[model samples]
Target: MFKNIISKQLYLLSYLIRWTLISIPVSVAIGSMVALFLWLLNWAIHFRFAHTWLLYLLPVAGVIIHLLYKLYGQSAERGNNLIIDEIHQPGAGVPKRMAPLILVTTVITHLFGGSAGREGTAVQIGGSIANLFGSWFKLNEADKKIILTAGVAAGFGAVFGTPLTGTIFALEVIAIGRIQYNALLPCLIAGLVGDVTVSAWGVHHTLYHIDVTDVSGQFYGKHLPVSFLLLAKVLIASALFGLTSMAFAKAVHQVKSIALKVIRINWLIPVCGGIIIILLTFLLGKPDYLGLGVDAGYPNAITIVSSFHQGGADFFSWLWKLIYTSVTLGTGFKGGEVTPLFYIGSTLGNTLAGILNAPVSLFAALGFIAVFAGATNTPLACTLMGIELFGGEYALFFAVACFTAYFFSGEGGIYAAQRVAAAKTDDNYLKKIFSKYRP
Candidate 1:
């Protein structure tokens, strides 16, 4: 027994050493290159060409995307789906043409003010690059998956500068109930290396600012009643927030289905959506809600938060954003939905926080996690992200709100291909559809 234990320990130690030696430097180099490309891409798109209205150039944008898709065929249509496909099928790596095509299309989308996020574009680039390495190295099927996961972590870490969260995301996102433990070391290495490289290049991230109170502080003791009440409010808020998020996701999916059914042209969906966005912008008299809504974070900006006390942000601010983002993403715009969810959540959370007389900072934090949990169906990841971004002071409240949101959000999510390993209820179709695919 002693000999077997000693041999097992030695084997584990050797594996760890080998992985560390291989992963660190490789991740660092790959991360640095990806960061540089993304930095250049963002600046060029935002400054050089963002002024171009989507309505004016949307036809051309449609032409380009259609041409690319027609050229690449169905493989191009599988952008992020390619990642999920690769995980399910080993010999499949993302096509070499994917990176350039996505980069070009995404740049065009952003430059023309198509509502979108940048992280999806970066992840495609990073994953495609790592796919090349796996193919060249003739890595085994398992290692191929590992490298792809590491690539995702690297890309997310580089963009967000949250290595730990990125690492967890890579591991947790592969499937709902199962995690690939073998992918952990590689993801950690890639995430850490990517964040370090991005920071070294002077890229900065927005930190969530909140006041922390000690567990035993006099103020906390006095505020205990309020805190408990706030927790209850958060739970209620998160439930409603989850329903809103799920509605947005399902609405986009439904629109895409309708577009595909009604417009057999296939290429006109995004163009039509773009036209609607333009019409909405004219009708609403504000373009602030048209894009990714990052400007919401700016001081004195026309954000939902700023207008909360003044009777909410222009009735359609949130709804317009939801429509633009949904159409932009669902109709094949290349970007992430996570950032937009944050925007929506913050807007809604801030409004409720004001009504309940809760701290804005606390509500903002809750909003961040609750929306994220609902959108991604990643309650645990959102909980950890809250703790990491908001400090440990509100861990209890954060966890409660996150899970509540997740439950209310149900089986639907931003990622349609996400596997449902287990369900809280046997009545749902999640069990029927996903039981066969659980890995």
Candidate 2:
């Protein structure tokens, strides 16, 4: 019995050490690559600001991007979906070329004034880098998937400086209503290490805030964190957030479908997309709805940071961003969707706060995570993001808003490859409950 116990402990110890070995190197490499990509992305955006004429060259840039993809990027074109597909079924193990290809294309998308997000780019970078390391280690089918998830966690954590949220998002985003515990250890370690590595590279993440005082004094009491009425408002508003997310997801898919049908010539889609974007920019008379929607350099820019203040964003800020991003990405522009979703959510939240008579910053923070939660179908991760980016003081509200948004978001999400383990929409449950009474 003593010998058996000793052997069991040894096996457990070996398991821990083995994963640590695989996960650390993968995380470090992914983190470094993400840092480099972020640096390049910043340079591209700043350079575009310096040269406004670059905006006019957007259609040409699209042509070049389409040609590049047609020539050597078909395999990597699926982007984040490709990574998820590989994880679900270990085929070739996420292509090593995906990292550089997406990195370059995403940079180009931003450099030429495309309105897109960075999360997808970071995630693709993470998955590809991690899978490559998995190959080097000669990991088995099971281990390869874990490493892939770890890569995603590392990329996400490093990109956003939210290790815990990254880990949970990587795990949760793979399947709706299902969290894979198989990658728990590897993902956790990779996320922490990845976040630390990016910080070591002197990359600074954007900061957000949420003050309790943003809400009315009537909602606060000595015993309760927030009044039930405020919670109700969040519930109602979160439903809209979920609907907005659904609309955005559907809009992207619809735009792509229509563009495909309307434009028989494959390469012309992006060129036309670029023209529409340019026209929109001229119509708006500013480039506010371009890039990541987090332009820190533009002091008066409408961004995630500005949405917390009253009148910081215009009434239609969310709608404009949705249109801009949908057109940009739908027509073959590279870049992720999460940051723009943040912009939309925060702005929408800002608008709703005014109407609801709630605290502007608090609702903005709620929108920040809630809409992402809805769009990604990862409420738990977005809730953690709220806690990480804003503050833990509103953790309860974050969970409430995110979970509500998730239920209302419908089955659609940003990642097409994500599996549907279960869906909890009220229509099905309500129909079931009232079916017996329908007679």
Candidate whose TM-score is highest: 2
Cα RMSD of predicted structure 2:
2.0
Which number leads on lDDT?
2
What C-alpha lDDT do the candidate models reach, one value each? 0.71, 0.90
Q: Between which residue pairs do clashes occur in model 1?
A: none
- Over 1-439, each residue of candidate 2 has an lDDT whose tens digit, in order, gives 9999999999989989999988998898999999999999999999988888899888888888898888878678899998888888988667778899889999999998999999999999999898888888989999989999999999999999999999999999999878999899999999999999999999889888775563333523455546778889999899999999999999999999999999999999999999999999999987899898887546788888899998889999999999999999999999999999999999999999999998899899888899999999999999999999987888888999999999889997989999988766557778899998987
lDDT of 1 by residue, 303-404 (tens): 534533334344444566677788777776666777677777777776677677666667766876788788777777778778877777788878888888
lDDT assessment of candidate 2: 0.90
The total of clashing pairs for model 1 equals: 0
Candidate 1, superposed: residue stretches over 4 Å from native: 48-55, 211-226, 296-299, 303-316, 426-439
Which run of 10 residues does model 2 get worst, by summed lDDT? 214-223
